[model samples]
Target: MLPPELPPLPALTHAESDLVDRFLEVLDLVGRINPARSSDTYGGLRAAQALVGRAAALRDALTLMHERGESSIHATTLARALRVLDGERRAARVTLPPAGES
Candidate 1:
């Protein structure tokens, strides 16, 4: 049996998965930059900080939507389940209301 605190893990739709994968690739790029390279001009450190910070924000938002009984809004993209609520027409689709505000 699953714990009550664990809101269901909705599988990411193809587009959602693609976006997350792209973000991971960007994160990989951010991680591969050499320490010295990041310190060069053009505010590299600040730019990296922005990227990491924004990614963290996105992660947090997705986590909240999936776990806690809160808004279904993702960082920028709504989940497949939510899109189903908007009457997505397809052969197969996931469907569910958010934790609250039915």
Candidate 2:
């Protein structure tokens, strides 16, 4: 059985690409820190510490986009890129597990 091909990622400017990368990094860290999902406090603490820097990077990416006159977010295009990069699964990890599953 063959897996279906993923859709091609939408074209993005340097700043937009950076923004998406930074945003995903932040999401990963947040997922790690999610108390409902995390098994160890120390690991969550580490993720929380790394989150401060990842968040700053995310802010920098957004600031660069604004400074470069990328005035509006192209949500539809960005959503495609995120989907290609598995953002849905990554984002889902930030939520609590289903009842009786955890």
Candidate 3:
């Protein structure tokens, strides 16, 4: 189910509506794909379709999850840590400066 924060489809921004529509398409495709097919050909097709559906969630989540700045900040923090580990602490700190300071 979609979060309550989501508004009506027509009112959604381009990215939001696209994700919502893609999610719905994946859901419908999942219904049509039979995961337990006896034939190898059919089984492969179903498995691929299932994997596609799974991937769609992450794709949709990319922008949807960043609806607010909290997750974006978390991402920045993680990226900074990764950069620090890679010996780019100065760059990371510059990219993600301390929250309050100019």
For TM-score, candidate 1 versus 3, the one ahead is: 3
Candidate 3 lDDT, 12-76, residue by residue in tens: 34444444445444544443343332235665577466767666674866556577432533435
Name the regions of candidate 2 deviating beyond 4 angstroms: 1-4
Question: Which candidate number would show the highest lDDT if scored against the true structure?
Answer: 2
* Candidate 3 or 2, higher TM-score: 2
Q: Rank the candidates by TM-score, best first.
A: 2, 3, 1
Candidate 1 on 1-102: residue-level lDDT in tens? 864463443666544554454455444445434343344645555556667766765576556546655444354344444343332322121233235623
Q: What are the RMSDs of all candidates, in order?
A: 17.3, 1.3, 17.9
- Segments of candidate 3 deviating more than 4 angstroms: 1-9, 34-47, 50-54, 57-61, 64-102
| lDDT for 18 (candidate 1) | 43
Model 1 off-target regions past 4 Å?
A: 1-22, 25-29, 36-43, 68-102
Error of 2 at 26 (Å): 0.3
Estimate candidate 2's RMSD in Å. 1.3
Q: What TM-score fits each model?
A: 0.31, 0.93, 0.36
Local distance difference test scores for all models: 0.47, 0.95, 0.46
lDDT of 2: 0.95
